[model samples]
Target: MWATGLGSGVRALTTTRFGGHSRPPFDSLNLGIHVGDDPAAVQSNRLSLAGVLPANPVWLNQVHGVDVLQADRVQSDQEPVTADAAVTTRTRQVLAILTADCMPVVLADTRNRILGVAHAGWRGLARGVLAHTVQEMAMRTDGQSRIHAWIGPGIGPDAFQIGPEVRETFLEIDGRLEKFFRRDSSQQGKWLADLPGIARWQLLQLGACDVQWCGLCTMGDPDNRFFSYRRDGQTGRIATLAWIET
Candidate 1:
């Protein structure tokens, strides 16, 4: 587990691909049920994870859109909500975002006890998922609280190669975003995109004053600690979860 150190009363962490009952490719500790891992193994893994949490996390369908759900309002028996982000002001309500290579972002206003988690891929970033999550948290605090964000493990700038259209999507949003992309020296007409850098920029722009990154790369995994979709297309997903410690 990688802790975010969000502060005294906040519990935020991202799970690595270790310590569970999955087989090869999915390996062990695969929390995502949709990734072709054995349902029994995935359930056992989730149960093991719940043993360390204050409550079972509220999972999302994560459509790579800007929709943010209220965790406190969700029913535990209901199916996973179709949203890329979730937020809560209620204590012990854990919000979870699953990802392989996509960035897992956790936000907290320790002052107001507001927590949020987002799954931001290139598409979600361009669609303003981080901004939407920040806005939702702000609404709960009446915009008086200062939000801090932690960007968990993801595909780093050097390992994430993209085409011209992906670069153009961000640039079209803000021409200044060109700084987050650079020509891939090895591949002609390809660009190395900075997923974490862009997320940090967006968080700062959204008034999240303290932005931290795990600085771990999913695709560049030398130890096989993380599950990377780009690195291993058939791999499982690791989860990033956050909640208020009641």
Candidate 2:
């Protein structure tokens, strides 16, 4: 399910499970450092990835909240920060996020002036991670710059069931969020959530020119590509990366 494209000076790739050396639960190609995979193994896997890509990816301690990071300066954490996004203007410095079910979004301007990536789960989406990322990108671009966003493979709407708390979040943001919810078949209080729709809505709100989505359902498809947390409890992570290669 990994894909790549080149436009202006930007080059990007979203990695699937075809490439690493992690074990069964972690599988092969596990890029997450926080997962139970051995530190040495994780390091080796990442180093292996570096050989194919342009630069070292900027890994984040994603906490499903609204904080966003700048890739030029990243730190080792005593505790994971409450951030779900990262942006950068530097060339060959990759900004990446690890995700299982959560949406991993990559954005780049046509001028290659800036690039950003975000891990937007329900919590971070409700809190405005996309909006914040666009704002951060704006600081580097002129007012005329427009963001081109691509929505990578994620848990599709049919598989993402949520409770009333999610409904409450949409209501809190705007009463119109109810339109995205529909009753789940197996559960009474739970409704199938539309994560991709919500993410597209957020990106539109941010004035992105082109929004591309893979439309691949990670949860529904268990082939050799993605890692779905909701489907596989003790699972590995896949990465979506963005950077300016020019």
TM-score of each model, paired residue for residue: 0.97, 0.91
Global Cα lDDT for candidate 2: 0.80
Give the 10-residue window scoring lowest on summed lDDT in candidate 1. Answer: 1-10
Error of 1 at 123 (Å): 0.7
Measured with C-alpha atoms, the lDDT of residue 90 in candidate 1 is 87
Off by over 4 Å in 1: none
Strongest candidate by TM-score: 1
* Residue 141 in candidate 1, Cα distance off native in Å: 1.7
State the lDDT of candidate 2 residue by residue for 1-246, as single tens digits: 444433567777778876778888887888888878887877778888766677667777888877888766764322344468988887787778898889899888776478888998888888889999888888887677767888888899888988888888888997777777899989888898888988887788778877877787778865748888888888888888877878
Show model 2 residue runs off by greater than 4 Å: 1-6, 74-82, 222-224
lDDT of 1 by residue, 1-246 (tens): 655657777888889999989998898999998989899999999999877788888989988999999888987557999999999988888889999999999998877889989999999999999999988888887558878889999999999999999999999999999999999999899999999999999999888779998898999978889999998899999999888886
Question: For model 1, which pairs clash?
Answer: none
lDDT of predicted model 1? 0.90
Error of 1 at 110 (Å): 2.1
Q: Give the top-scoring candidate (lDDT).
A: 1
